[model samples]
Target chain A: MTAVPDPTAELPVAIAARPAPGLGALFLTCLKIGLLSFGGGLSGWLYQEFVARNRWISDEDFASSLAISQMLPGANVVNLVICMGDELRGLAGSVACVLGFLVGPFFAVIALSALFDSLPDVTMLEAASNGVAYAALGLLLVICLKGVQRATKFPPGLVVIAAVAIAVGLLKLPLIPLVLVIAPVSVALAWRRS
Target chain B: MRDDDLVTLIAVFVPFSLLSIGGGSAIIAGIQHESVAVHGWISSREFIDLFAISRAAPGPGTMLATLIGWKVAGWWGALAASLALFLPSSLLCYGVIKVSNAHKAKRWHKAMREGLAPVGVGLVIAGVISIFRLSGGGLVAAAIAVASAAILTWMPRFPTLGILVLGAATTSALYSLGD
Candidate 1:
């Protein structure tokens, strides 16, 4: 696409102004996220690392990336990394991020599976892992709360949130359709509020 | 690794990659069906083992595909399967992001971000419930999760690794006692 130069187009420039982290740092960060997020809540940990720690992007950007990732086809966390990585450093950034994210688990899962196969007792081990999950949920909860806080000052946003939770979480609706229906309403509400 | 089995891995996972809406969990059932009932790469029992292992291991739950490939055809198979599963959707997501970036200056960008933020939060909560249920972590797990969340919120500086370690210790001790 040809670049349409617009004088008012300042938001992109400001967001893009944040110093790009080196590929190695990007890789390391993702590696930490991948290996450490054993019980889930990878996205929350991702928020903690990227937006919260490094200040790479605004909280709104992170949440929006997450929402976009959810609508797309792929693992939500991986898709999230892709979006954030792209924002940070273009294509190469995304490559480094996704590889760093996946490479550790590739080896760890194989090795752990081998270990599990050989070992006689994993009951305690399983319990421990579940414990890790229980705690990891805490991390996710914090991030979710933060996202919820950022989302709504108006009641409409709350309605959107409740609708999503009920339709998907309670009634077990498919996400894409729900998103297609809910997203427009949300965008409209946000448009009005903004 | 047999060439044919590798081909099968690619064919099976590529579609599922695109089908993985929301997250990797969306395709788990289809993956299981293909591997176990259709191709017979592994039995039903073995699929469960791999699922359990994927959960226990770090990274995306879709690493279940990686594990399946590892079992079916070895390292090359694992690589092929994972690439097939993740690459297509990654490309699509990347394109969408690029477009979104191009429109970064638009007024709607702010509105879209704000609007989707709540939806994202809701999906996140839904995901939390599902992941927690999958673990069958029970009441003790529930209590620990809430307590841990409280502690983390209160003390943002607290190291994550320490909390996780504490969780393991606490839960394992309780489990051993109950047993």
Candidate 2:
């Protein structure tokens, strides 16, 4: 594809030396992602905002953060926002992001149940929800495939990817034990090669 | 919310919060076990509905905690449960990020990054598989997934919200036509 001119390029260097996103910006962005992302694509939405759109972090940085978030405990997306937020504005940013992200969804879920209860048995609601869910899966598939594409460039990386997919996806092993078994070995192998 | 109910919420969610390595999906079965069977806080049917609503709503699947809390003790239950589920892991994530940022040039950091990348990829693919299964075996769902993915991959600029809306509309139309 032809190179699109970056809009930031037009700005004077002195003026362009902007600060990192403040807590408010982080909060709003997280809130937007939280409210808009309908189905199971919270991570994908996060990637879009932080990496793709805002250019807050490099793709590799985002990927590493993502890896760490997934490997650690809690909701993957919530952990992601925390990592990103902390990077941007320390503890306060982390707090803001989680609060902004969850605040909307908190009320939305409650409202949704109430709405469903109040409605006169709309037949199409479930169908639409399923579609949205599938589409969200599609969003996830796009990101996952891209991750695979990036990983497969190295043979060892490809092997690791395959091993994890089978162990977690197919075998359906308990994650904590699986990670305990796999993570250290993978890190050690990478350590040796490096 | 009753004082004891909040205590029970904290008791059940805190350990699961820490034990939820590889994200909240890992602890879902445990939550179900505690809520539906052990605690009798919500019935099995309500659990399923809340799960669906959580998926369809936004944010994390763990927001099922919020819904459960709402059912048990109104809005305060939602807040309490949400905090119990999210706060501990987030604190852990905050510490990890700080360490990683501080030691940018460390060899072990590099190793961790490299090793974790493929693992993350695998976990995401595993997520795709799980969502597919949860969606049930449907040709339409499969097709929407493939089509949306293709659009995202090739165009790279298509609005995700548009795709979601389109998917919902198409699926709604199709299902509404049946029976």
Candidate 3:
């Protein structure tokens, strides 16, 4: 994971993908993510930064991290941050990333709550925030579409995706049990396709 | 500011943290149950208001824990609740990554990686649904979402912040004019 641009290394070797993000860069990147990410779709934003723009992690690594983070019990965004942070710079890197991610909203929520009583029109804010959430959903849908197209290449992948979406999204089934039932079949199919 | 209040906040959120499979939205109802019905930290009305507040603020909606903690006590309560809510699962995640990461370049790992990709897609779809539901199923919201999606699809380099601002501005203008 350490991809720091080494000065002494020969330039004739494989071209460096990008400079490895140091702890400070990780914190700032995550901090920017925390502040800028209004609504949800945070995973998409992280993908844009780490995979598309920065070349910090490959597309496949991001995909696998998404899988791991979603499977584990926590904030999907937070879990991804931890996984990528650890991969980037070990335990301390994870700490910086997590703290950077949480710190902005920690104070923002409290401060906003204090102002909650003072606002003249909560409904107006509601209208605006609803708009924000809606737009964020659009961004998320784009990523969802991309993920679907990629997953379809593997056999039975589209079937698993549709089944899980129906069960969890429409039926509102509890995630753990649904995943428990679906995961083994999904993994086995992927193995066969491989 | 009571010590017991801090302890209570911790006691309540720790369980929700681990139980929050799929993400923070998963345990929102549970958090509501405990905070409103069980602990009486806040009323149901306050819960709704804070939910909006957390949503509007620039972070995860789960930061409702911070608002509730602030309401229950003050800054210290907010700190306590935030820690309790975020820490346990984080440690568990850290441990899991540390262990599973021990093996790499294996065939099973590749299978796990490929298999999990669709699962995340399933999750993104579910999140889109739940959040749509949360917004009272507004057709206007649906239109705005579709518009923004199209915008991003074509101009992948378009600044997202601009989209969000435009969304807020458009809705706010429409609502005020309608009113």
Give the winner by TM-score: 1
Off by over 4 Å in 2: A1-19, A188-194
Model 1 regions lying over 4 Å from their true place = A1-18
CAPRI-wise, candidate 1 is: medium
Order the candidate numbers by lDDT, best to worst: 1, 3, 2
User: For residues B1-179, what per-residue lDDT tens digits would candidate 2 score against the true structure?
Assistant: 69899888888888988988877767889999999999999999989888878877877888898888888888888888988998888888888788787886898988887777677777778778877887794788889989998987666677888889988998888876875
> What's the true lDDT of residue B78 in model 3?
92
How does candidate 3 fare on TM-score? 0.89
lDDT of 1 at B178: 87
B64-136 per-residue lDDT for model 3 (tens digits): 8888988898999999999998999999999998887777577877787777777777877887888788778
* Top of the candidates by DockQ: 2
**Steric clashes per prediction:** 0, 0, 0
Instruction: State which docking tier applies to candidate 3.
Output: medium
Model 1 C-alpha lDDT per residue in residues A1-194, reported as the tens digit of each score? 78655433232312443587988899999998888888777887887788655668777778778889999999999999999889888999999999999999988888878987899988899889889999988877876777666555577877887788878877889889989999999999889877
Score chain A of model 3 by TM-score against the reference chain A.
Answer: 0.82
lDDT of 3 by residue, A13-85 (tens): 1234576699999999888878888876688678767765576875556666876788888888899999999
DockQ per candidate, 2 decimals = 0.51, 0.61, 0.54
Enumerate residue pairs that collide in model 2: none
Give interface RMSD for all predictions: 3.6, 2.5, 3.7
lDDT string for model 2 (A64-139, tens) is: 6777888788888888888878877888988998999999898889998898778897667878878888888888
lDDT of 1 at A84: 85
Between prediction 1 and prediction 2, the one with superior lDDT is 1
